[model samples]
Target: MQTPDQIWNDADLPTRRLAGLALNPSAPQDVLLRLLADGPLAVRMVLCRDRILPDAVVDAVIEHPDTYTRSFFARNPHVDPAQRARLIDDPEWFVRAHLAEGPRMPSPARPKPLPDEAIVHMISTYEDENMGSLGFYQQISTGLRRSLHTHPVAKVRCWGVGRWSGLSADARAALLADPDADVRERAQRHERYEDPACMERELPARPCHGRTDILLNRALSRAVVDGVLTAPAREDERATIAANPSLPTDVVVLLAADPDPEVRRRIASRADLGPDERRGLAVDPDPKVRLAVSVHPELSEKERAAIDYEVPMDCGFTFRHAPEVPPAPEAVRRDALSAHPLLRRKAAGDHSLPPDLVARLAADEDLGVRVLLAQNHPHAPAPLLLRSFLEYTGRERAHLTTRPNFPTTGLAAFADHEDPEVRALVALDPETGPATVERLTRDPDPAVRAALARHPNLPPPRLAELLDDEELAHVAAANPAWDADTIRRLAAAPLDGRT
Candidate 1:
């Protein structure tokens, strides 16, 4: 068996392949445990912190000696939220802190609510000291947040007092009269909300997304509404305020015909829009306003289709990674079958659409519809995934290739393709010739060369050559053809070892 030292004249402590080995879907359970126990930071990250681990690997990672590894695992997004409880009692503060923050980017779907026991523990026992704005994401789940007031633990119920601005009037009164001294005290402390100057003082001198978010969250006093709506120079602020849930009836009527198209457009999104308001906005001169009102739930599919809404085909269109609020399943079903292409596009991104709908959207005429289906739906057919990958070159374009059904075995045929992006797919195929692998190592495109450098079939001599080539060394080190002894040599060596 060739050693890593034999693979390179002098290789820097190699980890690129170690990381790759950790990501191999076919890697055995023991291999994963070994990687978690002995792997470098980069290896541990991919193995324990990125992929969902089997039960054995999960236990090993939970008990791993390295604080850094354990801490990273605390926040691993791919695993069950219930599994996060394994560390709930872990002594490390930051580990508990990360658990408290929930998974990173935890969206595109509402994360399952943490089991009530975990929430009760976090809400009752912890200080809010380490929590930043995202720490407040605890309040984001409506059902869970609302239930906090009824919790058996008084300290847990105390956290609910902080949501006074968002509470139902009945909820506020209940908290104020609560048996728990702490909960009642906290509720009383929030009474400053009655003083409109408190809200006025908190408003920033300049408008920002944060200020806009604050405006949207709180019910503005009449004085605050007057100050906000009078900002003729601040059209954007006025536009954002137009959609505030707490906007009064008269203000709602006033903003419905505000001079700025964006203000009217915001008004169009309001659920409380009267019948006359919806009809008028449906014919607004700005295409954006009509587009906003087109999907109003009150409107029939036929009525929505009749609106002159434009489905964007602009070159710059990009998919939003995680829609903050996933459309209701019924809405997804409705849009999946809608006459309008825009409505179809909305359905295309919903992974929950049944197989029949997934298939229909996979063959959609709109390019955005097809690409979104490919990017979002796990069961998107191999052919559709391939077609969408080729036709679309926008943001997240590369994400399509990583789909589970993306064809890899036969992609060797594209070895000589014109596009370097397509040419790179050749390396992913298991059957690519050693000759093709060697040739692509010198290809014009660095991405193509880098990908091909990691193929198991790459000629060992050329693999050795790339180990010395700084540009490709990391990925070349990631090649999986090295024998067990060679891998052990690399693994046993320091993460920053010299060849």
Candidate 2:
């Protein structure tokens, strides 16, 4: 047999075709390049996954006649940034859409900023497809601002107004009155401009009323300065600034002394904080601040334990039992469980805990703790818990009934449960037996009776029996299987009788 490299370089069309069948990682790079463009789409697709495909060849395939071939390159993380940039404007919307929606394109070791023309084209084409293209939006916004007075496209100018509505009052007022009606309309409706003074207020000096407009304006300004906004910001803007991961190191460092507890909390949570900063915050005056820092995800278990040791009991317990970190061990877990019922409730819902830990807490004496465990436990045995609660009355049974997957077995067993809520749960269970439905039809709750009357599996005779129960009869009449005759009968049924 020919060596893999020799087979790839055979040059004879039949030999090259045969050689392409060999899936060797060491296949000649030149041969892979030729095959990437000229080979069948499948062969080219496979070649796209090869780490050996040079940047130039990848660039060439990006504009290949076949969209699937271009998509393969677009999805490849190794594809050079320059090539990826060019493909962002591929005439085929599918290819452009794929590029826009694909995983973050890895930037080069020494990446050059995308050109203004390319950035503008990407923003105009792909903004609707993926709003997270923040770099592209920033570039376009910057360019539009520089050329706003004479920008050719009103739509582009309008995009600038919508994008930069978070700017200062003078700047926002100018955009709101721009020549384009759409720009004016967007600015007028803009949530950012609703509060005139919120964005201009200096934080740590004074706090504003927590109005929607004030929050939105402050949040938007903070987001623009920080380069990106996390999906959720904290209640306090000072805390938001201190906790923001994307802020410059200098800016974060300067925020360390911010007087607000929330701001100090954010500083404690900073991933970039050096050992000294961590230590300093570990002993900070504020208990909340110390707790927030101790539970920072960046801190190792050892670091957290150390911080827990140095802190006071209330603060240490808060940090030790914080939802951010996993329960330290069985001993620590027991301590957290014993500290406060609320702490036990928090521990029960900590997603990072082992499933067995959560399962153990699922039967906690506190209904809230059990409810939290049931809700957050990934492996919660719903059937068993529901079954166990079959004999529970009042609020306890009501709580179980609200879970996402209602315990059908337990609920089915409670078909004759005296409480309307339990009987109601059984009536609504998709797995409810015909006998269970019959029992629920007599439930005192009109809602439960109505649910049973409309059940598709309900026997025709049983449904007819409900025709006398006004609310249930009305629900039964709406079922598609109920004929016009059935509806007519239900309409004439007496309102006072039970179904």
Candidate 3:
């Protein structure tokens, strides 16, 4: 809070002087002018970051001999359109790269749209593998998107082709006749794409031709003989009918004794089979039938836990296709108050658990158990959720803050907490008042600023102030407060302005 003169007169570390400069957002133009002219690169960078900068000071920074000094303005949204035009063509590729992404930066008013020519320039040079003027594409009008359908660059035309839903029938027809093979291929492919109704109609009628296809059809009306399918003239057809749960219970029991091992395998997968039948199938000579019984949805929890296939993770394979075993509701409710915290944690998600049990889990000593209660227990009391915020440290507090009914009436206490991470979570809470949000906007931490940058509750003026920060560009673009037209206007560069 020292006077600007004091900052200049008593400089110890340049960073200290810069810190002092940052404290005074409304520092006079003359002071900024001197800093831009005389300050070291770090001090000057900090000067550029201030929300307000005089025209002369901006010009001085732009005219500086060092590429980094000049380049810094390219990423800054406050740079006027005329200044941006000049910076966009700065000799440094780094400068243009920053400007290409500059549209994402916050602006009090929607930024003047980049001309179509500038967009083409950005497409040609500034794009990398990760981002390629994607926000620009999101903002442009449908007509502009269509115009790119025939753009000389294949990549641009390909991007245009991908917006299939937006194209007019006539335009699509023209694309089908396009000289480029890729354009024609995409257009032709889109032309042949069927609507849901058409796809349903085109599906082959019943009495399917292939043995495998016939067996899989759930709708085939075929007769069963003594619990064995007799309609299929073929052996595999009987196996498939045996697998169908629609078959009568007596028919399935008959199929269990069929000569074909495949018939028993099919029966092993049926949902209607009783426990005794499954136990018999579990010991079938065919390993596939035994494996199916082991993983069957009806298998008891203890039974499933005992049937260990190769523990896939221990075998060094990171990805494994395994059946999920959800604990039964009755079992989960029983375990909700168990001495084992892990079992209690697993049971916290059971919707059928008594309300009192849910409250107990919410107050569980383990942080993870409490988090599960917050996420899965809909009836968890407000006091328990608030206690989580007040008692827990780190991100656990943040987790409780996002829960559906977590109390926000008195959450102002955490608004100015020392931890930026905690403050960032508070910023995301929909119930946090605008006054608290506006105060957090001035928070020194960039992480907190980033979180506030797109918070729906943040007042527009405060939201717009964040536009000047390059680090917050993406979040600013995504703020829900912006109406569709406003987003379109702010995100896209227009074609009329040639520069």
The candidate that achieves the highest TM-score relative to the unseen native structure: 1
Off by over 4 Å in 1: 1-123, 133-149, 158-177, 181-211, 221-223, 231-235, 248-250, 274-283, 298-307, 315-331, 402-404, 492-499
Tell how far residue 210 is off in model 1, in angstroms: 7.2
Badly placed stretches (over 4 Å) of model 2 are 1-259, 280-291, 306-410, 416-422, 428-447, 456-462, 465-470, 479-499
Best by lDDT: 1
lDDT of 2 by residue, 54-168 (tens): 6667656865787777766655544444566678768887767656554333221112244556555665556565535544443333445555533556655666665453466
Over all chains combined, what TM-score does candidate 2 have? Answer: 0.37
Cα-based lDDT for every prediction: 0.75, 0.54, 0.58
Residue 3 of model 3 has an lDDT of: 32
Which residue pairs of candidate 1 clash?
17-478
lDDT of 1 by residue, 1-499 (tens): 2222343333233665566557655556667788887766767765766667798888888887776677777767778877866888778886787677766643333344567677777766767764444543542456667677777789878877876777788988999899989888888767654545666676666767656755776556787788777763255778877877878888888888888998999999898888788889889999999999897768887778678898777653234444445678887888888877777887887866799899888878899888888888778899998888788877767777777899887888888889899899998898999999899989999999989988899999998777557677667766777665555554555556344
Regarding lDDT, does 2 or 3 come out ahead?
A: 3
lDDT tens digits by residue: candidate 3, 1-499: 3333453445334233333343234345565565566655555554564345677777777777766566556545554545655665677776666566554442112344455666555565655541365544543434556588768876567667866666778777778888888778877655544232332333343445643443454333333232225344454667767765456677777777677888887887788877878877776777766656665657755765554322111111011111124557677675675554445655765645677788778777766566556645556678776665655554334545555677756555678778676677676577888888778777899878767766778888776655444455435544666554443333232222210
